[model samples]
Target: MEATKSADVVVVCAGLVEMAEVEGVDRDTLSLTPGHDELIKRVAAAHKKVAVVLSNGAPVSMPWLADVSAVLEGYLGGQAGAGGLADLLTGKVTPSGKLAETFPLSLEDTSAKPYPGGPLVVEYRESLYVGYRYYDTAKIDVLFPFGYGLSYTKFEYRDLSLKQTGDKVTVSFKVKNSGAVAGKEIAQVYVRDVESTWFRPEKELKGFAKVDLQPGEEKEVSVELGTRAFAYYDTGSKDWVVEAGEFEILVGASSQDIRLKASHKLAGQGIVSAADKAKLASYYNVTPTTEFTLSAFEALLGRPVPANIQPGKGQFTMNTPLSDMTDSFMGRQMNKVMQNEIAKMIKGREDTPTGLTMRTMAKEMPLRSIAMGGGSLNLSKLKAILLMINGHTFQGIKALLGKK
Candidate 1:
């Protein structure tokens, strides 16, 4: 502490728990390990020139961020990590990497908690609200957010414009390096459905452009969006579909740091089938037993259901058989049409049902095993296991594992 107080700069090297992603091991908290946090705090108190260098693969809560003079996220940078960091510190190289995830203010502020629950099953309760999506939508505060990064220089965004041509929307903007040092700036473009039939996140990243600029230099950045950019994955149709509505275009350096905005209207492809549309209506309203009625469904679908059909007394649930809803000739024909459409959607997606089943099993079995106390099966551990199973010598395996 005394040396830190006297030193010109105190560079604190810290990281997350080493057991991250290992079997039967998960971080107990988002904060830095107990001793590390205290050490950084104490050093920051004693020294005005305190810089923290983090070697974590994931975001960590930084309570003392305001107290530190600077922060460098090294991110488990292999053998050459130290040299690269040294270059960054000495002003030999400018840092350009951006955060791929958000850092919550508190662990509780995250979307899902009690993670890795149960020995045999871990439910993904937070469907689409994963990282920045949750924080941005819920208006939750965070220490840092996705796409956040700092360079030795500064950049300014201006001249925002949007244009639509047949199914494609193009966003164009200008980025200028306003600082003395030359560096790169990543301009991110996000889209939000102004009004949607199905629930949607506030805004989603659709495109980005990275531009390197010299001091006082400016460049025009343009990002194009296709159908998928404005579309949502509709499980009912087993296809991506864009609904007719207004969509807001957001440009930002980070998710929370939105700088420019524009709006566009989509005419919509109107490609969803009537049966699938009915299925969506039923799934969203009837099955959940909400106050939503057939009329509302009709309004959404832009058509009415068959006149002969009648929902039975009481609210319908998924358990209610299709036959119970109606027995008329039209109803039976609609069912057959739906069945054929579903078959068509499923066909050609996979060559064989066996291949599809095996692929799904291969993807899910590992998660199940990991939840059931079978060791973690991540890429790193898988590589290690492969080295061992291939009968390679220990030294050879170690050499292969060495930093690139």
Candidate 2:
């Protein structure tokens, strides 16, 4: 401490240790392990100009952030990382990298708690509510949010617009460099379903564009949104379906730093199957057997079910297994209809089983089962099955297939 007080400037290189970052080793805490935090605090108190260079892969709680002059994140950089840091520090390279994950104020503020459940089995209780999605939706305060990065220059956002044609949404906004130096800004677009029937995250990242702007230079940025942007995975239908309702378009530099907003109404696609409609009701926190009626199902499906179909006696929950439902008169009819429709959908597929049975396959089938030798598969049907089994969106499957 005494030696640092004599220096003109203090540079503290602090971050997680090797044990905390390894794959199999689980970190016990989100703190800067042991005396690192205290050391940084002492250095900041001793020197007026103190810059902290973090050298960890994951986010750590920084209690001394406000006391430091600057903080640079160097996330496990490789051989040339030291040289890159020197260049950034000396103003030879403008830092434009952003945080891909959120940094919580403390360990308790994070979504993942009681982490690393067991050596053999690790249960992911957080599910989709990970990182910024959890913090943003739960309204939890964090030290830094996803896509947050500070540059030497400043940028301004203005004139946000949302244009929709059929199922596509186009988001456009103007960005200007308001500071003295040239730098790049990553503009992010997040969408929120205002009145969805199913539960959805408060906001989801739909699109993002990065642009380099010279000082006083202005540019118009546009990001396109497809069906997946405003849709949810409907487990019953085995498809991604968009609910008809209002959607909020948010444009911002970071998840917590939303600057502009607009709303759009989507004309939802009608449901085709009775199972999907029931699942949608379940998503709305309603028991399908009690809250759902035959009339309502017909309305959503855009066609009437067989007149003979009737829910005769006891209460039925959406969680009721398909086999159990088949004992009822209405259930039996609905089951046959669903089976016929499914058969028609996969009529010509090579992988279509000779005898379709309720029995589970003896072994896991490879993804290539849908494809024939040197021939194309039914991509639409394959996408539906993929979404059903793997819970992946069409865009996600496309990414796995290396398609643009």
Best by TM-score: 1
Expressed as tens digits, the lDDT of each residue in 1-404 for candidate 2 is 88887777788899876645654234557888678999998888888999899899898888898999999999899888999998888788788888999988888776555453432234443444678877776777889899999998999999999888777889999999999988999999999988765656679999999999999999999999999998887645778898888899999999988989999998886343555545445223322122334454444444554443322224333323233444455445434544564566557652422222211111112233334323454545444433423334565457546676
Task: Record all residue pairs in model 2 with backbone atoms less than 3 Å apart, i.e. clashing.
Answer: none
262-329, model 1: which lDDT tens digit per residue?
A: 88888775345565556445333221122334455445444554444334423222233333324333
After superposing candidate 1 on the true structure, give the runs of residues whose Cα lies further than 4 Å from its correct spot.
20-24, 114-119, 269-404
Please identify model 2 stretches exceeding 4 Å from their true place: 114-116, 270-404
Cα lDDT, all candidates: 0.70, 0.70
Evaluate model 2: give its TM-score. Answer: 0.66
